[model samples]
Target: MTSKNEITVTGGRLYYEVRGDGPLLLAMGSPMGADAFAPLADALADRFTVVTHDPRGISRSALDDPREDSTPRLRAEDVVAILDDLGAETADVFGSSGGAMTTLALAARHPGRIRTVVAHEPPTLNLLPDAVDRHAEVDEIVKTFETDGLEAAWRMFLSTSGYQEDEAGPPPSDSPEQDLEDGRRFFVHELRETTRYIPDLDALRDGPFRVVVGLGADSGGLLTRRTCAALADELGVPVVEFPGDHGGFIWDPEGFAKLLGDILMTENVRIPLARV
Candidate 1:
């Protein structure tokens, strides 16, 4: 069974859901929100103590410090605060896209807090020499959000992310306009603060922690996959292949969950089984 609750943090109240009954697993979603992780959380709940929460300014989470600024490192600190609040000594963290970037930052900054990290396709453009143009592209995206409006900005972001129209359909628009407004506000802060998130490679390498760089089998040839490959190489580790693409947890929730569970178990995760 999954139970939803809220936790107070530096910013405001952070809504989170806890489920399953095993080793603690912290699933961090993209910068979008924790709702994006629902499917994955449900799937993993059977064998793991799954915990998913809304990041600082997104969803049910409120902003406390107007000056928080939402930088990657600070964002990481928020996650650490969550761990501290929960009284968990360590956890297994899984993050994708922006969340993946945040995971890397967290692992690098709070090495002792996490036992293992599985980051799937972190969009770390700075790591790619050829991706220098992405800075300008993202800058234009931010500008579009400010001027042309949310629809245009969303479309442009998808295009830049290589999701061509007619192929990936429209951006999941339950309320396109409203979504854009919220996204724009949050991303404006995230982009400004996130770009400065440079991982401390030396610290990551020397940190006594196990880091898993995972990529989707279907996400091959994508920039995210490439980034994962590079990160694995830098860390002197192999990039493990997950069940599906960037949104695998949503696309194939059960399969993705099983893959995640297997990986965590292999990485020395111990979940106390309930005995009859």
Candidate 2:
């Protein structure tokens, strides 16, 4: 079962959806809207109430100013508003990439309203040793996007992200104008803000909620995986390995959902790779 609703947040109306029934779990991503989590959410619906939504300025969610730059702190506030509207005092949060950065912010700022945070491969470049150089590379990618176009910028972004272009080449040619614009908003505007965000490690270490830094089993020691390890080390926790690379939920929904359920059931039980 699924139900949809909207909430008038500070800058815009936030569109959200609810599926299944039980303990509340919010699954989110920065540029990735609710659509991407459908399969995982569905698989978890039987045992957990799953909530997914588009971050403001993308998909059904509407932001008053599309040009407004989004940051992890601001996106954290958005999650709070969504939870308040849904009458959920607290929830387990599963966030990937940019969403993982937002989850860290939520845990840092409002630990009382969160049960646990399962942060999957947040690209917190600030935590990395070569942050300055990495950020410069990202800046160059943004410059290329501004000077050239989406396709050129995308190529640079993929290459920098450690994604290899196969013999078949990039995934389809030519994204529509709207998609290009969204990419502009994300890469040009949001990417730096999200990656550069330094969470209050002291607060997180002593906070009541459990903070689990996750890494994809097949993600390799790329940018995101390295950052995840850094964060877990800082927090004095183990880096939990999941089913697949960064976007694991999409590829192994059943296994992902079961792992999440196990975590919730055992209150911070680490899901082993063998089980997944």
Candidate 3:
């Protein structure tokens, strides 16, 4: 059974969904929201109670101020709020892309609330040596959005991120207006903070929770792949290879689910089997 619910957060309401029965596992994304992870959640439902949510100001979640810029710390607090609402002391979390940055923040600030975290291809430019250049590129992308328009900004973003539009295809969107709004939010409010987030290496390295950096086997040239490698190196942990590219979970839900389950079980043996 699947249950959809909403809870009041600091600045707005958070919309989330719960599925299946077992240990708590939160599959989340930043701009991507709960809907993006539905297939993966469904695939893991039999063995885990998967919780997915829309980040504030996105989709079903509503922010009191739409213009409010989202930061990793704020989003991390939101995750803790969700856990508190569910009466879950801790949860295994899977965060993809921008969400991975949020997961890192959660692990750093509230390690007690997480059993394990699988951070897949977080675009943490600050971790890389060429971060200055990359950040400049991001600034240019944002500027492009302000000057040229959405499509031009997106084209630049895709190119800089090493995704070929012809090969990877356009990103999925609900509607043109929604897409435009999301794009604007990402470019103007969320992008810079997310990509430039500096992970607390000491906090994560010494945190009680297990932190696993995941990389896509097919993500050779992608900027996120480099970030994943840098993160793994900093943490002194090997990068766990997943099935496909950055959007692997969306493309191969079954395979992604299986691998994620294995990692959680094998890496978190000390975690009790009882449900949260």
In model 1, residue pairs whose N, Cα or C atoms come closer than 3 Å (at least 3 residues apart or on different chains), thus clashing, are 11-64
1 or 2, greater by lDDT: 2
The lDDT leader among the candidates is 3
For the record, the alpha-carbon RMSD of candidate 3 to the native fold, in angstroms, is: 4.6
Error of model 2, residue 251, in angstroms: 1.3
lDDT of each: 0.74, 0.84, 0.88
The digit string of per-residue lDDT tens for model 1 on 110-221 reads: 8888878888777777776766687788888889888987667777777777665644522464776546545855558776556446667787788878888777777764
Question: What's model 2's lDDT at 80?
Answer: 97
Model 1, TM vs. native: 0.89
Pairs that collide in candidate 3 are none
Q: If scored against the real structure, what TM-score would every candidate get?
A: 0.89, 0.93, 0.94
Q: What is the lDDT for 3 in model 2?
A: 93
Comparing 2 and 3 by TM-score, which wins?
3
> What would the TM-score be for candidate 3 when compared with the true structure?
0.94
Clashes of 1: 1
Tens digits of per-residue lDDT, candidate 3, 46-150, equal 989999999878877888998999888889999999999999999999999889999999999999999999999899899889999999999999999999998
Residue 36 CA error for candidate 1 (Å)? 1.6
